[model samples]
Target: MIPEESRFESDPEELVELPPTLPDGWEIATPDAGDRFTVARLTHLLRAHESAGRGWAGAGVDDVLLEVSEASLRTRENVVVRDPEGEIQAWGSVHDRAGGRMLFVHVVARDLDERLGRACSDVLVEWAVGQARAVGAARGLETQQIDTGAFADDERQHRWLAAQGFTMVRTWWQMSRPVAPEESELVPDPAEWDGRDVTFRLVRRTGDGMPEEQDLREVHEVLESAFTDHFNSHEETFEEFLHRLRLEPGHRWHHWWLAELTDGPEPQPVGALIGEVSPSSNGPDSSYVSYIGVLESARGRGVAKGLLHTIIADAAARGRDSVGLEVDADSPTGASELYLGLGWETRYVTQSWHRDVPVVEAD
Candidate 1:
């Protein structure tokens, strides 16, 4: 039998110095895939954490399990604080998303004693910092960036993150638009929408049900160039881009789309949209606009609206409840106006927090 103490993680001795010491009967241990009780506790903790922050629970068991699953253990790790009886009271997860970007998740049980809750928060944040250092050093980076988020109304989360050296970096507007069954007829099948010489349609697929390499490459190129001027824009290689997107539970091949300028002698791919299926346990599933971009040259045209219409129609055809997306609340383009004109409404708002810390040099 694997000892619970060492079951989930093997901390890097060089990066992690002086282990955490918790007060009360709380104990620190990483989560293990084989432990059913720990997994249940983690799911509960995630749900409770979101509910406390936004007035309703969003993440379910499957979503929590996906992040900590055996397959995902390669680039992600999770730690939790357990009571004397082994029930989890706090949780944290770290993902080495890129060379210097480490995605972090921190959650403390909302119902615990106030004093103990703060203690748990401290330990979790400290662990996250150590993990950042370990990840950065391994990547040969001089500094590592820890990126985390919280609901707009989550003051407790804000306070904890601020106390630990994290600063609010950005605010995002989460918006959703209802999809009606009748809307399916608006775009019709083969959804090749066109306006002002711009064309929007799904990415081509080969007979083997795999996407054509050229089309996929075009999609990536279009998005990369389109977002060059956007906030916090970071260059991602094609390999890294596909690897991360494919890992998402919502990723779907048929949902990929492209916008093209056909007035030229040859079709020029100038925009792309990657849609995913957002599963719902208690209601009809929704379609999420994971990444949507239109080249600056094609902005004045209706490329973006056409891409959105295709997704909305596709969602309607699939019997989805709504279409959802997140946008930069303070975007220079004032893109929120366009979304609002198209019937999208803010459902909730979220904030991104970031901490840049020095990495310990690897031996």
Candidate 2:
């Protein structure tokens, strides 16, 4: 991943390190290259937190690295806290996500004392609150939205966010579907298949090995249009959309797919699916559908199913263990029902917590 320091552009409010918000005898500052222990512990904190909250841990080593990498620093700020004894106690990262939404990853040491844990959570959240205002002010937004998520079963996390004025806004089912090797032939070659006048194929690429600009734009437009009426929909520029997706850990160009109605006047793009290569430590890697959208106008025309079928077939052909995707449980289009019919099962549940804070404008 390449780093671009120009992205955040915090100017005067560039997140001054260690603002003395943490308590005495606790070291709080942004992570640096010299602190390998701090980085390793942060990854442990995430895995341990997920394991305890849900039934399993899915964030792999690479996934954790991307969270704290230099490239990530372009749009994210991270802080790590260590005790006077030099033991890392907590770590947090705040991402200046699209529009006015800021994503906070609040991870505290699972084995710390209950009192210390609360203190650490408070420190992390306070820092995030400040960062949110800085980003909102930079973007000239009146209301900054703090978006954080936690496993549905984690009562502790719920309490922490609730106490911080965040309300549970949505529930998501993280679903997975196993792909048998024989399922590779499930679809007759995505490139050549035109099912019901809707064609399913990978996003076109040029000789430069980069996705075609027109195709990329179409995919972006399809998703933006698809989710326009959904919950908490926000307008994200094409550049912002492309930049964020490229920062994903397992991001790849080949994983992107688009569906278009071939019989239409000039073949209109109606559906899109952006996938990620999920590397597993023990087995074949999986294919994760990071973003999948079918236009509301084309919903009943089997566009969504065609895209799903193409991904399943592609995963099987690639020898992946499974295909994973997240679906909003309260989707207006009954999306969860579609996945349920396609051999997917819910492995875990997550909830989105949001708090809206006014932009902390410069005095």
Candidate 3:
């Protein structure tokens, strides 16, 4: 329950307070739109430095730019650490998700002396948690959980997070599938399960390319119902859900699809898939499944499979190099198996760490 008017102040001068204990010649600065390229490059460097044999597929500048642009909405604060020479060396951000109930804190840095690395991480995380508390107070929330993640094999990050009071809570598999030439030859037909009266179709869109209001609502409803039982599920308003996804770099209306059963009195929405084009680290560009879900009543009816196949087919038709998604490794639905069976393979694993922080009114 953040106070309605307690939004994060983004005044750069007020945001760049460096810790007194930071190594001499190191400073902190709030990033702006102009820092996109530099931040992207620094991020790539940090990923490569920390990635343990798991190749880091770094985000593109546009991806970073979109994140920065969306910060006003979701981010409590973000900062970059630089050396005396002004070379960006590290970055951190705290994201307020689900309206300040959950905060995601991320910290990354280039390989540095053990002491300096630890100090820098400590300062950023401390500032991030402080901001998270302010966000919760503004929302009128009494408490919130601070969440963060690290590559499973990155011991340095894992150790740092542990020292910051986080505990490993979940693991995720980042998976990707290369688009096959033959995939384009596959018929673009709705999937049907044996003896199941189920069907799928591209969501109807207006001439302006926006999905019809009814279809959009159905998409949200289907996903909400489908993921109700999922890990860390939380109810977000339809407006929040839609706007959050649209804030990403490649969100487009045509990338949405729905699965419905026509065997009933009328078409009933049972599943939905939303996708976006993304800049790939391995190839030209890729399609990413941002959200895919099937209603509890529609499980095992090929509805989820149908939506996935349709997405792959669409990606192939557009000559995208690959399709990528992240799945909860502990998903009760065993979704990883389905993706693996469909040619997707795990590229890397990341672990989610969480810490419950007490919320108090902002001073």
TM-score on alpha carbons, each prediction = 0.91, 0.93, 0.87
Best by lDDT: 2
Clashing pairs in 2: none
Cα lDDT of model 2 by residue, 211-314, tens digit:
89999999999999999998888888888788888988889988888898988578889999999999888999999999999988788999888888888998
**For candidate 2, what is the TM-score?**
0.93
Local distance difference test scores for all models: 0.82, 0.83, 0.73
Evaluation by TM-score, superior candidate among 1 and 2:
2
Q: Where in model 2 is the C-alpha error above 4 Å?
A: 1-23, 33-35, 361-363
Native-to-model Cα distance after best TM-score fit, residue 190 in candidate 1, in Å: 5.5
Expressed as tens digits, the lDDT of each residue in 1-363 for candidate 1 is 111221123453322332344555667776886777777888888888889888898786667777777766767888777888878888888876766788889999999876778778887777888888776777678898889999999998998899889999999999999999998976756357776798888888899998998899899899999988997676676866776687888989989999899999999998899999999888999999999999998886888888888899899999998999999999987688889998999999999999998986457
- In model 3, which runs have C-alpha deviations exceeding 4 angstroms? 1-6, 9-20, 35-53, 70-76, 100-105, 185-196, 281-284, 361-363
**Residue pairs in steric clash, candidate 3?**
1-139, 1-140, 2-138, 2-139, 2-140, 3-138, 3-139
Q: Model 1 lDDT vs. the true structure?
A: 0.82
lDDT of 2: 0.83
Q: Can you write out model 3's per-residue Cα lDDT over 193-277, one digit (the tens) per residue?
A: 2225766666686898777888888999988888889987767677767766777788877888888887889878888888999
Top TM-score hit: 2
